[model samples]
Every structure is written in C-alpha cells, then in structure tokens.
Target: MSKLQEVFKNKSGNVLNVYCTAGYPHLESTLQIIDTLQKNGADIIELGMPYSDPLADGPVIQQSSLVALENGMTIATLFSQLKNLPSSTGDKEAAIILMGYMNPVLQYGFEKFCKDAAEVGVSGLILPDLPEYEYETEYGAIIKKCGLDFIFLVTPETSEERVRRLDLLSSGFLYAVSSSSTTGNEKDFNAVEKYLERLKSLNLKNPILVGFGIKDKETFNTACKYANGAIIGTAYIKALEGAANVEQATKKFLAGILK
Candidate 1:
C-alpha cells in the first residue's frame, strides 16, 4: 500500500495534513519545513508547487507563491530538493503530497512530473484545476502508472451524485472544501457541519479531509468530528511570515492544532 493509504488504514481519525509552500520563506527551505512538520505532529504534508496564478489560494498563500517564484523555485528545483528529503529529515513519517496548479505542471511535462514525483518519494497529488473528465480520459492512467494517488476536492455545492463520482475516481482522501470560495476565508461551521454530515451519509470510497478556514485547534477538532481529518494551509503560511526560524514556527503551529 502507498504511505498515504497506510496512514488511513492504521489511523481512522484526527488525521492532520498540513500544507506548505515549497521554496517559500527561502528557496532551500522546502526540506526543512517538511522535516520539521513530520517531526512535530503532521501526519501528511501537502507541499505546494508555487504558481503565478493560484486561483484557489488566498492572499497569504498567493504572496508566499510570489516570494517563492522570486526566489527561483521551479518544479525541477523542487524535485532536486525533495531528492534529499530522506537524509535531511532523519525519519520519513509523514506522506508527502504535491499540491499545485496544472499550468505549471503541464509546463514541466505531466508524465515527467509524475515520474519524478514518484522517484522522489511523493505519495500523491492535489491539482485543483484538473477536471474529472480530463483525469479519467487523459491523466488518470499516467498517475496510476506512477503509483501516485490523486485527490479530488468537493464543495458544499457539489451534488451527491457528482461527489460520489469524484470519490470513486480519487485514490487517496477526498478534499472536502468547506466553502465554494478560495482558501483562508472564514466559514460557517453550522453550514459546514451539515455539509460534512451529508458527505458522511454518502459512504464515499475515500476518506474526507475538510480544508479552508481550518486554522486552529477548535476548527481542526470540529472538522474531525465529521470527517477523517482536516487540512491546514493559510493559517500555517501566515504563521511563517517574517519568522526567523521556519522549523520552530512549524512546530509551534502544528502543536497548537494537534496537541
């Protein structure tokens, strides 16, 4: 089984998947952040490949992406850095998943991207802009061939039928977007709970991880009550801003959520 699959099979709840912008804070800080996160409490790490037009990200993450780009972080550089993740991190506990826009991934060549990702010990991918029809027709086979899992996102507005369809296509956990808007926005927990409950009733094939507005312990715990876990992105990035120590910042951020 993939590392991500093992995580779910062994632990059924309170799964904390933290998202970080690769090459953010500094170009060479990718491995540092990943290592620190897993060592602290993160079960899965979603390393974002910074892109110019990150349609789904909020201002904080967008600014991080801008800085990362300015610092000269590309997919090639990210792969090279990830190549040393094992030796740098000490112990590889958390499953690493790449999150990025399709534009950059396509520019890097999709097949090569998947192969290199697998070679560097990446477990899965989260391409929000990749449509379901395109995946089934063109990219699904390539992803499966590389032994990489693909995660699909579903919002409260998604119909039950479509949600189940995505769950069937997805290999890892299904990302349940708390709202139909961009990341880092506030959400209505009452409405979010009803949505999560609705998703739970569907009996999806994959685990559900609620993202967007999941910034603290309360939100994390609240999300876990209905889904398998929660994904923290914007809050964590905001924490890293202007911080002197990335490792210490990551540890403190994760502790506040998982401890």
Candidate 2:
C-alpha cells in the first residue's frame, strides 16, 4: 500500500492534517516545518506549492503564497529541496501530500512532477482545479503509475452522485469543504451539521477530512464527529504570520486543536 493508504488504514480517528506553504516564513524553512510538524501531532502534511493565483485559498493563504513566491519558491525549487531532505524528515510513517495548482505542475511536466514527487517520498497530491473527468482520462493513470494518491475535494453544493464519483477517484482521503466558499472563512458547525451528517450517510469508500473554517479545538472536534479528521491551513498560516519561532507557533497552534 502507498504511505498515505497506510496512514488511513492504521489511524482511524481525529487525524489532524496540517497544511504549510513551502518556502514560507523563509525560503529554507520547508523541511524544518515538515520535521517539526511530524515531531508534533500532525498526522498528515499537505505541503502547499506557491502559486501566482490560488483561487480556492483565502486572503491569509494567498498572502502566504505571495511571500513564498517572493522567497523564490518554484515547483523546481520545491522538488530540489524535497529531494535533499534528510531521511529523518521523510519518515516512512508520515504521509506528505503536495497541494498546488495544475499550472505549475503542467509547467514542470505532469509526468515528471509525479516521478519527482515519488522519488522524494511524497505520498499524494491535492490539485484543487484538476477536474474529475480530465484526471480520469488524462492524468489519473500517470499519477497512479507513479504510486501517488490524488485526493479530490467536495463542497456542500456538490451533488451526491458527484461526491461518490469523487470518492472513488480519490485515493488518500476526500477533502470535504465545509461550505461552498474559499478557505479561512468563519464557520458555525452547528449550521452545517446536517450537511456533514448527510456525507456520513453516504458511506464513501475513502475517509472524509473536513476543511475550510476549521480553526480550533471546538471546530476540529465537531469536524471529527462527522468525518475521519480535519484540515487546518489558513488558521495555521495566521499563527505563523509574524511569529519569531515557527516551531513554537506550530506546537502551540496544534496543541490547541489536538489537546
């Protein structure tokens, strides 16, 4: 099984997936962030590849992306950094998924991107704009051929038929957007309980990880009640905005959710 599959197979509840933009805070901070996250409580690490236009991201994440780009974080640079990461940082048990837009991957050559990601021990990918039909016909085989899982996202507005289709296409875990909005928006879980409950009733083959607006312990716990876990991106980025210490900020922020 792929490393990502192994993670979900062994850990079944409250799987805390943390998202961090590559080269953020500083250009050389990628591996350090990953190491700290692994040593902390992050069950899955979604490494964001800096992009010029990130449609699905909120202001916080978009700003971080800009800073990361200013730090000279390119797809090529990220791959080079990943390739040279210490063995300790590429822990066999920890699953790392590269989250980015298709433009960069296409620029770097999709097949080559997959090959490099596999070589660097990346377990999966989360391309927000990669359509289901396009992936199945054009890129799914290439991704799976490189032994990488391709995760898909689903929003509240998604039809039941589409959700199931996405669940089947997704290999790691299905990213369930709490609402039909960009990341980092404030969410009241009580209002979305029925939507979450409806997803639970679908009995998708892949595990569900609710994202968007899940910022703290209360939201995290509520998300976990309806799915396998939760993903924290904008909130974590907000925590790291100007913090003197990235590791300390990561530790404290994660503690608030997993504690």
Candidate 3:
C-alpha cells in the first residue's frame, strides 16, 4: 500500500493534515517544517508548491506563495531538498502530499514531476485546478503509474452525482471545501453542518477531509464529527508569519487544533 493509504488505514479519525508552504519563512525550512509537524501532531503534511497565481488560496496562502517564490523555491529545488531528506527518522513520520497548481507541474514535465515526487517519499498530489475529466483522460494513469495518490476537492455546491464521481476518482481522501469561497474564509460551523451532513450521507469510498475555515480545536472537532479529519492551511500560515520559531509555532498551532 502507498504511504498515504497506510496512514488512513491505521488512523481512523481526527487525522490532522497541516499545510505548509515550501521555502516559506526562509529558504531551506522545508524539511525542518515537515519534521517538526510530524513530531508535533500532524498526521499528514500538505506541502504547497509556490505558484505565481493560486486561485483557490486566500490572501494568507497567496502571500506565503509569494514569499516562497521570493525565497527562490522552485520545483527543481523542492525535489532536490525532498530527495536529500533522511531515509529513516524514528517513527514520527507524516505522509507528505504536494499541493499546488497544474501549470508548474506542466512546466516541470508532468511525468518527471510524478516520478521525482515518488522517489522522494511524496505520497500524493493535490492540484486544485486539475479537473476530474482531464485528470482521468490525461494524467490519471501517469499519477497512478508513479504510485501517487491524487486527491480531489468537493464544495457545497457540488452535485451528489459529481461528488460520488470525484470520490471514485480520488485516492487517500476527498477534500471538502467548507464554502464556495476560497480558503481562509471565516467559518460558521452551524451553517456548514448541513453541508457536512449531506456529504456524510453519500458514504463515499474515500474518507472525507474538510478544509477551509477550520482554525481551532472547536472547528476541528466539529469537522471531524462529520468527516475523517480536517485540514488547516491559512490559519497555520498566519501562525508561521512572524513566529520566532517555526517549530514552536507549529507545535502550538497543532495543539490548538487537536486539543
């Protein structure tokens, strides 16, 4: 089984997936951030690849992407850094998933990108802009051939039929966007509970991981009640913005979510 599949199979609920931008805060902080997150409480690490234009991201993540780019982060640099990561690091290991747009991957050569990702222990990819039909027709075989999971996103407006279809296509987990807006929007759990209920009724094959607006323990717990876990991106980025220590900030932020 892939590392991502093993994570979900071993951990049933409240799986905290933390999103961090590669080369953010500083250039060379990528592996350190992942190590800290894994040691803290993050069950999955979604590493954001800096992009010029990120449509699904909010201001916080957009700024992070900009800073990461400014720090000289590129697909090549990220792959090299990941490849250099230690082969074994005790038992505290979080499954890694690269989250970014398709343009960079295309620029980096899709097949080569997937091959490099797998070679470096990356378990999945989350391309927000990769449409389901296009992926199935063009890149699905490539992703699967590289032994990588490709996660799909679903919004409240998504039709049941489409959600089911996406569930069929998605591996690892389905990212459930809490609202129609971009990431980091303020969340109202009561307003989102109904949507969560709708998704829970679908009985998707892949586990659902609610994202966007999940900031603290209250929101995390509420989301977990309906899905297998929750993803925190913007909030964590905010925490990392001016923190004196990235590791400490990560630990504290995850504590707030999993507490």
Q: Could you tell me the C-alpha RMSD of candidate 2 in Å?
A: 1.4
Cα lDDT tens digits, model 1, 135-191, are: 999999999999999999999999999998999999889999999989999967678
Per-candidate TM equals 0.97, 0.97, 0.98
True-vs-predicted CA distance for residue 110, candidate 1, Å: 0.7
| 100-155 per-residue lDDT for model 3 (tens digits) | 99999999999999999999999999999999889989999999999999999999
Clashes of each: 0, 0, 0
The reply for model 2, stretches above 4 Å from the true place, is 89-93
For each candidate in the order shown, give its overall lDDT on alpha carbons: 0.93, 0.91, 0.92
- Per-residue error for 196 in candidate 3, Å, reads 0.8
- Compare candidates 1 and 2 on lDDT and give the better one: 1
**Each model's RMSD to truth, in Å?**
1.2, 1.4, 0.9
Local error of candidate 3 at 201, Å? 1.3
The digit string of per-residue lDDT tens for model 2 on 1-259 reads 8888888898888998999999998999898888888887888999999999999999999999999999999988888898877786345446889999999999999999999999998999999999988998999999999999999999989999999999999998999999889889886778877899999999999999999989999999999999999999999999999999998988898888888
